[model samples]
Target: MTEVLETTSGSSPRTRMNKRILTLAATGIGAAGIAFVVAGAIVFGDFGIAPDFSARLAAPSWAHWFGTDQFGHDMFARTVHGLNVSLWVGLIAATLSAFIALGLSVFATTCGRWADMLVSFLVDATMGLPHLVLLILISFALGGGTHAVIVAVATTHWPRLTRVLRAEILQLRHADFIVVSRRLGKSWWYIGRHHFLPHLLPQLLVGLVLLFPHAILHEAGLTFIGFGLEPTKPAIGVLLADSMRYLTAGNWWLGLYPGLSLLLLVLCFDAIGNGLRLLQDPRQAHR
Candidate 1:
C-alpha cells in the first residue's frame, strides 16, 4: 500500500507538470500572434499581394477565418497588417512624446525664470487648442501619412507629459539627495542621470505605457478621417472607414471585425498600463 501511494503521488505531480506546460504553450501562441501582426505588414507586403479573390465576400469559416471585404481582400490579412501599423505608431509616438516631455521637464528644472515662463506660455497655448483639431491641422500641414501622424500625435500630447514630469521633478528637487548633489558642484547632466532620473523612472515608464493606447487610438482616428496611413496600407481605421460604405448592404463583417480588433488592442495596452501602475504601487501590491 505504501508503494502504491508513492506511485499515485508521482503521477499527480506529472499531471500538474503537463498542465503547466499546456498553459505556457497557449500563452506562447498568443504572443506569437501579436508578433505576427506587427511583422506581417513589412514581411508580406501587408499580405495584400496574397489576397484570395475567390475568398472575397465569404463569411467567416474554417477556410477564410475573418471573412472578406467587399473588394475580396481577406479581412484577416488586413487586420494583421493593421496591427503592424498600430504597434509602430504607438511605440514611436509614445517614445517621441516621452522624450519631449522629459526635455521640457528638465529644462523647467534647470533653466532660468525667463525660459520657464516662455515654455509655460507655449505649453498653455498648445493646451488651449482642441487636441484632435490640432492633430488634423498639423497632419494636413505636413502632408499626412506615417511620419506626420507620429509627429502630430506626439507633439499634441506632450504638454500634459511635460506638466506631470515637471511636477515630479519639482518634488524631487527639494529631497535631501538633490540638495547634497547640488552642494557637491555636480553638473545638471550628472545630477539628472545619477539622481533625478532614477526617481522619475517609475512614473515615466507608467506614462509611456499609458500613452501607447492614446497614440494608437489617435492614429486610428486620423486614418478614419482620411489623414493617417494611406488607404493602401490596410490599417484598422482605414478598414473600418471602407466598410462603412457597404454596411447598409448587409456586409457587417467588414466593419465589425476591425472595430472589435481595435477595441481589444486598445484595451490590451490600457490593461498593461494599469497592471504596471498597480505593481509599482507598494500599497496596492498586497491588496
Candidate 2:
C-alpha cells in the first residue's frame, strides 16, 4: 500500500556544484580534526605523568609552553593526555549509546503494540528528567571513577538517538519493500537483517559521531564537580579543579590553556560529526 518515489535521472549543474563544495568542505574539516587529535597524542603522550620539582609553579616559557602545574608537571603534556582520555571515553560511550539506541529502535518497530508503547514511555520518561543531574547521580552512585563516568554518559545519552531511530524504523516499516517482505512470510528478524539494518547504517553512524562532543563535555563537567575521574588522574576536569585555587594568585596559564584545549577538542569533534553527516548524504556526494 505504500507509494514509492522515483529518483530523477540527473541533477542540475548548479546543484552538482553545490554538492561538490559541501563534500569538499566536510572532508577537509573532518580530516583536519582527526589529524590534530593524532598529532597531539603522539607528541605529548610521554610527558603526561612526569613531574619536575625544580620547575614547579614556573610560568610559560620556551622550556614549557603551557607552563608548569603546582607539582611542576608540564601542562602541555597533561592537556594532551587529558584530551586523549576524553576522546577514548567519548568513543566508547558513543558506540555503546548507539548500540542501545539501535536495539530499542528495532524492538519498538518490529515488536507488537505493547512493546512499541513501552519503548515510547521509557524514552519520554528519560527525556523528562534533567540530563546533567541524572548523569551526575548515576556517576556518583557507581562510586565516581573512569568506568562510572563512561557508564553514566553511555546511559544518559541514548534517549535522543533512540527516538530518532524509532521514527526511522517506523517509517521503514511501512515502506513498499517491507510490506512485500511481510507478505512473503519473512520473519521480523529476517527483514531487519536484510533491509532495516542496511538502511539504518547511515543514521547510526551520524548519531554515533554526534554523540562524541556531548560525551566528552559531560565527562569533563562531572569530573569538575567532583563526581568523575579520580584526582590522581590528569583529566581536564582535574586540571581545572586544581587550577582554581591558583587563579586567585594570578596563575592564569594553568587553567586557561587546558580550558582552551578542551574547548578546541570539543569543537573539532563537532566539526567531524557534521562533516561525516554531509558526506553520508548521497545527494551531496555526486558533485
Candidate 3:
C-alpha cells in the first residue's frame, strides 16, 4: 500500500478528503482490533489444559471457531491468550526501549563531547552484531521467559531510535533559543524540562509506535525456538510450533488460523504506526 502521501496525496480536494478518511478508517480499525484482542484475552483468560479427546484434531466449527489442537485445546482461545502475552511483552519492551533511546540521546547531546562519542560507540557496537543473534543470546542468558524476552528486545531494538533521537536532540540543543537559554544561566533541568521535552516527545512517540512490530515479532521468534516463553504458556510461537508436527497429517487449521491471526495483528500495529507518522507529517496531515 502507498505510504504517507509523500508526494501530492491526491489529485483533487475530493480525492484528498477521501484519502484522509481512508487513513482515519485504517487507523481506527487497527485500534479496534488491538482492543478486541485485549478483551478476548481478558474474557478467555488461560486456555484450559483439560483435554477433550473426543474433539481432538477437530476442524473449524461454530462451537470451536478456530478448531482444536492435537490436545483438543481450543485454538482460538489459545491464539488469543498467546497474542495477549505477546502484546504485553511487546508494549513493555517497546516502551522501555523508546525511553532508553530518549535517555541516551539526552546524555549524549547534553553531557559533553566525550559523552556523545561514548554513546556513538555503544550504538555502533550494538547495531554491528546480528539482530536475531543478539536477541537469542540475550534471551538465553536471561533464562528465557516473558521478562527475558522483554529485556532482550528492549536492549537490542534501541540503537536506530537512539541515533534518530540523538541527532534530533543535538540539533535542538544548538538552536538559537537553547543557546540563549544557556547564556541566560538557565539550569540544565529547566532547559530540559521546558525545551527538550516538547521537541523530543513526538519523535519519541513515533519511535515507540514503530518499535512494536519488531518487539512482537522477535518475541514470537524466540518463543517458537523454545527459548522465550515457557512450554506451558499459550503463546503464538508455541501454537505454531505444535502445529508443525500435525500439518503433514492434514490438520492444517491448527497452524493456519493462528499464523493468520499473528500476521493480522502485526499488520494492525504497522498500520497504526504508519498512520501516526503520516499524521505527524505536515503534508500528509492536511491531506
Candidate 4:
C-alpha cells in the first residue's frame, strides 16, 4: 500500500498576495488620476486644455479625450483637476481631524474629568447639528472658499474620531500590559507615549481611512451648493454643478463622467478601509 501524507500550507502568502493586488489597484488608479490632475494644474492650468465658451459642447474624440464643456473647457482636464481637489480635501481634512481627535482623546485619557466633559460637550453639540448644514454655515461664516472648506470639514470630522479614540484608550488602559507598566513606576506620559500610543495607532489609522471618504463627499457637496471652492476652479463639485446645465441638452458627459469618477473614488477608499478592518481581525479575514 502506498503511504499517504498530508501537507499543511500557511495562508500568509495568499493573504499577502491579495493585499498587494488590492493596494496596487487602489493606488494605481488613484495615483494616475492624481498625477493627471497635478500635471494639468502645473502645465496646462486648472481647467486643463479646454477651449473657450464659444466652442459649444463636444463629444469625446481623439482631439478631445473627454470632450469640452459649454465653455469649451476639456471635460477630461476638469475631471482630473477635480480629482486633485478631492484628494487634497480628503487627505488634509482626515489628517487634521485625526490630529485634533488624537489631542482631545489624549487629554481626556490623561486629564480625567474636566477634559472628558469639555470634549464630550463639544462633540455632542457638533453631532446634534446637521453635518452638511453645519458645514455650509461654517463655510459661509469663514468666507466660503477652498481653505474655509478644509477648515470646516476638519472641524466637523474630528469629534467622532475623538470619541472613538477615547473609547479605545479607556479599554486599553485596563489591559494587563498597561497595568504592568504602571506598576513599574512609569509615568502616565511615558506610558502613553511608549505603550498606549502604539496600541491606539491601528484603530486611529482605520478611522482616518474611513473618515477620508466622508470629507471628500462633504467638500463636494459644499462646492456643489456654491459654498465650496470657486466656480472658476476645477473642482469635482463645480464640474458636477456645471454639468446639470447641459444635461438636458444631451451633454450627459458633463455630469455623468465626473459623477462616476467621484463614485469610484469614494468606493475605492471605502473598499480599502473595509479590507483593512478585515485584515486587522483574523476571524473576519478567514470568513
The candidate maximizing TM-score is 3
lDDT of 1 by residue, 177-225 (tens): 8888889898766777788788778888889988987899999999999
* C-alpha local distance difference test of each model: 0.80, 0.86, 0.88, 0.82
lDDT of 4: 0.82
- The candidate maximizing lDDT is 3
lDDT of 4 by residue, 1-287 (tens): 12222123344556667865775577556546456556765665634644687656989888777788887888877787787779888899999999899888988887768878998999999999999899999999999998999999999998888998899889988999889988999877787788778878877888998898999999999999999998878899999898888889899888988888888778767766776766676666553
Off by over 4 Å in 3: 1-10, 46-49
| TM, every model | 0.83, 0.89, 0.92, 0.83
TM-score, structure 2 vs. true: 0.89
User: Lowest-lDDT window of 10 residues in candidate 1?
Assistant: 22-31
Model 3: lDDT to the true structure = 0.88
Worst 10 residues of 2 by lDDT: 1-10
The local lDDT score (0 to 100) that residue 28 gets in candidate 2 is 75
In model 2, the runs with Cα more than 4 Å from the true position are 1-23, 283-287
Candidate 3: minimum summed lDDT over ten consecutive residues — where?
1-10
Error of 3 at 49 (Å): 4.7
Residue pairs whose backbone atoms clash in candidate 3: none
What is candidate 1's local distance difference test score?
0.80
Which tens-of-lDDT digit does each residue in 1-287 have in candidate 3? 34445344546666777888888788889989999999998888655455688888999999999999888898888888888889999999999999999888888877788998999999999999999999999999999988898999999999999999888887888899999999999976688778998988878888998899899889999999888888888889999888899999999998999889998899888888878877877877765
